[model samples]
Target: MISRGNRGNALEALVAGLRGTPTDRADWQAVIALANRTLLTPDLFSSLARAGQIHQLPEDVREYLRFVHDCNRER
Candidate 1:
């Protein structure tokens, strides 16, 4: 199982990658795969969103974040 710190790092890296001038497909894919392997919680989701960088994320990632946020709310 992935550690919380590592998961957070992956999210941060993904955000950073998305915000870069030229996105890297391999890095994005690796981050997305990491995200898939790690369990996301409300607090982590909130932290990622609070970074104010969601606009830089890909549409699919944004949608996934929204879905996770909604799911967190439902809990």
Candidate 2:
């Protein structure tokens, strides 16, 4: 399980990556891993969306985020 602290780190890494920061493969992997481990909350989704960061993400990552968002909305 991903601890809250680790999840926060993953979120930060994701945002940084989306912002065009020089993140490595590991950082990107961490974001994907955390996505599988946690649901996308409205606050986080809206934050990314409003910042236009979501559009900056890679296609696969954006798709995964959308999948998570859709799943969360159904719950």
lDDT of 2: 0.60
Tell me the whole-model lDDT of each prediction, alpha carbons only: 0.57, 0.60
Give the range where candidate 2 is weakest over 10 consecutive residues by summed lDDT: 18-27
Q: Which candidate is the best by lDDT?
A: 2
State how far residue 62 of model 2 sits from its true place (Å): 0.2
Separately for all candidates shown, the number of backbone clashes (residues 3 or more apart, or on different chains) is 0, 0
Per-residue C-alpha lDDT of model 2 across residues 1-75, encoded as one tens digit per residue: 667876778888756644445244334556767645554333344556667666766677667667767776788
Clashes of 1: 0
Model 1 spans with C-alpha error above 4 angstroms:
1-26, 41-44
Q: For candidate 1, lDDT tens digit of each residue in 1-75?
A: 546766666677755543443234324445666655565433434555676655665787667767877887988
How well does candidate 2 score on lDDT at residue 73?
79
